[model samples]
Target: MTRNIWTFITCGLLFSAAAVHAQSADIIISKGTDKTTIDASPFGASDPAGRMFIQVLTADLVRSGWFARGAQGASEYILSGSAGGGGGFVAQCRVAARGRSGTVFDRSYRGDANEVRRLAHEAADDILKALTGRDGMASARIALVGTLSGHKELYMADADGQGLVQLTGHKSVSITPSWHPDGDRLYYTSYAKGFPAIYELNLRGGSIDRVANYAGLNTGGVVSPDGRWMAMILSRDGNPELYVRRMPNGDPVRLTSTRRSAEASPTWSPDSRQIAFVSDMSGRPQVYVVGREGGQPRRLTLRGSENVSPDWGPNGLIAYSSRIGGRYQVCVLDPRSGDVKQITAPDADYEDPSWAPDSRHIAATRSIAYRSSVYLLDTLGDPPVALIDQKGDWTAPAWSPGR
Candidate 1:
């Protein structure tokens, strides 16, 4: 979307200054040849706000969890993009540490002005990928709750936890902002009028539409990759049970027929042909996967008090958050072999694990010192590191598909 003038000013006065200062700081790479010192070279564009725009772009890049902090300072390969005068064409620019001066990578695109930010993001993603031979995080978004005036609301933030945009400002509790495969809209649960219901909020139109309204419970809704259906938990059938509903029109196709055990946290497999959900049918909450057509379910995790929010990763891996030793932490499992591996050893409760679109990083919400925040855990790295600090309570982190 075309950023408001106020948004520009806020970025200029706040994050821009930080970016300039951060440029002087060192950039660390867990897996790299060596750290390089480069600059966020100047950009000449018709738009007078190019500096501030670049700062905001840098901030966006750093927040993706792919780039190191103070990126502008250590960017041996400088890159830039700008919106033109008519707001129609975006002039792209880049300079790499090729030999003398640098090698330049430049391009232009004729599109909507709102695409300016997207173009910048695309440029950053390209640069990062070319450098590391791995994917970047610029294309991700964060899902959290935004409370105002004692009302709990739903929000979607940039991957860095900035650009906090409220998706639902209902005068009630609205939590669990999940993303569709397209990333243009958000699916969340809201208690706007007292009863909890699932709603879809469109980011472009700022409109909220109810997706499901059952008699007892309607929560933990996650859409499949094909965008054809949503796997959620509902109590309309009598007790809390897992259900799959067609999108656009809430026509639920019950997946589980059990009434004795409560089932929730239904996550879809990457192929969209199966669903991994949590069921107490085994006496406690455990991870189980069943075919979309409904058949025999194979249990996954066998440790901890309860294993919830089982998200299927890109490959043959399933990640879930389980309460271990009275504290919740994230763990990974091989659905076929039933092999389990603990990824997060956080001293506090760490729940709601959302796998990054790259399948390399897992973002989760952890409770520390009575407050909650989001942490990014690298599957191949050391441990989980907090991404969003103790500023505000953040939960229900749903990573957007690579944009």
Candidate 2:
């Protein structure tokens, strides 16, 4: 189909690949700064759902970088709550500093039995915000592409891998799932048409539309945080390069011109003024950044022989997967200092690192024995937590910016 026709189809449709390889590393736990200890009191004395709420909330708090699980022995804070209301599940949660300092959070959440976990997540987010002065990712969702049913399909789950929902039934190769700035819509590449084409799926309305179906390759479509442009990789102009197109409909503006080098995995900085992408212009795949308005590209990584899947976090850290000692591990780079810190141990190959909105934690794919699963790694301290326990090869996790 012609480019014009495809654009028309995408507009009418309303919406939207990453490559994967198998490798292995060791899991190394690093001790960093001390974490705040919070003692969590039990909730819901008589209701089973209330107890479930406390369990889920405790897990969320532990997964959050700011708090560690412990008893009321010398804890900095104490989280106590109760669940009641014979008709439905009602959670009354409160977080207070030890020694009668004050109550940071005192709120009540009411929901049906099916929403017990969600209610707990909401309470956890509020408690985090009240205590740490930072937003919590407990209520956020993550879009991922996995091969669970023998074919690559798009799937989504809560940040903790609960409330799993399958977004696409393409039964074909669907990859590179990206979230709209609003987090209610998603864009991904599906090969159901015998070629890679970008499609958009609306989570609220259950609708799917083709966003970009150009001739060559139409993949890696990430909507800018400002929701005004989309940075994607297209080869219609001869070589696979990064291009930024205005939202809804606008002619794509070519941003990179590395003649023989192919660019993949384009991510926008928090301010939306620059984009970090993967290119092999120097004979090996590495991360590079270029101005959003199209200018000379600047190389970012100097150590890794192969650095790809760059994700620019909201807190100004660029997290990417770097090949070290022949194994791909998650590493974060300070764009301003050129200092790099490897987060994952050399136990298993970790790739496709996506940062949470807080920027202190990262979600990436951990592969071992050729079996892949999504894992959440805290950049501050603590070990990586496996987000999903299901049996599937989950890869390319895109974390939402919280509701």
lDDT, candidates in the order shown? 0.69, 0.84
What's each prediction's TM-score? Answer: 0.78, 0.90
Task: Flag regions of model 1 displaced more than 4 Å.
Answer: 1-49, 53-91, 97-104, 108-119, 382-391
**Candidate 2: tens digits of C-alpha lDDT, residues 1-403:** 2433433332232211001111121222245446789988644445788788888898898788777886755788887778854788888888888888768888999988788888888888888888888888998999998887889999999989988887888889999998888988898999978889889899999999988888899999999999999999999999999999999768888999878899999999989999999999999999999999999999888765899999999899899999977899888877876656677766799999999976788999999988899999887646788988877799999999876
Winning model by lDDT: 2
Write the residue-wise lDDT of candidate 1 on 1-403 in tens digits.
1223332343334334335433221211223123333356555566744443466556645544455433554555565445464645455566565344745555554556655555566666666666666676665777777443356677666665656666666888888878888888888888886799999888878888888887989998888989998988889978898788777676787888777888888888888999998898889888888898898787776555688877787665888887765778777777765555555554678788888866677888888787887778766543456665434677778888876
In candidate 2, which residue ranges exceed 4 Å CA deviation?
1-30
> What is the overall TM-score of model 2 with all chains considered together?
0.90
TM-score of model number 1 = 0.78
Question: Could you tell me how far off, in angstroms, the CA of residue 151 lies in candidate 1 after the best superposition?
Answer: 2.2
Judged by TM-score, which candidate is best? Answer: 2
Global Cα lDDT for candidate 2: 0.84
